[model samples]
Target: MADFLGTDANPSLDGILYPSVQGSEGKLNVVLFHKAARVQALDIPKGAEISADLYVETEDGLEIDYSVWEEVPPESPSATSNRDPLDAREPEDYNGRVPTLRLNISSLRVHRVNHIMFHTESHTVRRHRFEKRGAEF
Candidate 1:
C-alpha cells in the first residue's frame, strides 16, 4: 500500500502497487493489509513474530528513512467486555473483532512521501502438539 501527498502518479509504485491515498501537508501514511491469502501462503503459524523495515520516497526524489511502528493487535472480546462505557474505542465488526498487522507511518515533519517500501521478515518456532494421556505409548 502507498500514500501520496498530492494527486499525481508515482512512478515508483508502478506495476507493484496495492492501493494509493491522497493526503495534505505533504504527509503520507501507508498501511499494508494482512489478508487471509498472504497468511496462508506464508504459512504464518499462530503466535509468530514478524518485523519489517520502512522506506519512503519524497516528491523531490529524495529517499528518507521513516520510522516503522509495530503491529498493534486488536482488543479481545473479553477485554472489550470489561471496558467502560465512557472509554473511546474503535468500532467492532459483526464478530466483535479487529484484525492485526496494519502498518502506519509515523513522521514528525512533512516529507512529501510519494512511495513506500517494506522489507519484512518473520520468525516462527515449531512446537510439538501432543498430550500424554494416562500413560505414554
Candidate 2:
C-alpha cells in the first residue's frame, strides 16, 4: 500500500499542506479548513503563514535539506488587515503560484518509511498531516 505519508526521509504527502505541525513549539490547537481538507491549525509568528515543500531522502540514508521548501509558494495567505468579524466584504484577491514542496529522492530505498517535517521561518518542525485546505479539496 502507498504510504499516505512518505517513508523515512522519502515522504509522500497527499499534497494537502497544513499550516504547521501539531503539538509542536508555538503552534496552537486550532483547525484550519480550506477547500475541503481539514488540518490542525498552526500558530505561527505574527506575520508568518502556511507554506508547502517536498521532503526527499537520498540513497546515502540522509534526508534532503529543508531549504528547498523556499521555492514553493504557500497555498494559504498571510494574515491581512480588515479583521472585522462582522464584515462580509472580500479582501484583496490573492493570486500566486501553488507552493511546491520538492524532495530529493535520488537514492532512497523503495519501501523505506519516512515522515515529512513542516517548518516555519523560525525553523520550527511541524508534526501533522497536510489535509485539504479550506473545504473544497
Per-candidate TM vs. native?
Answer: 0.19, 0.19
Candidate 2, residues 1-137, lDDT tens digits: the string is: 22333332244343333344644766544321222233333334454444543455778766645432223335456545447766664656332334333334454344445775656577678799776768666
Model 1 lDDT tens row, 82-128 = 55767765655123223433333332444576887655579999888
Give RMSD to native, each candidate: 25.1, 23.4
Model 2 weakest 10-residue run by lDDT: 31-40
lDDT of each: 0.44, 0.43
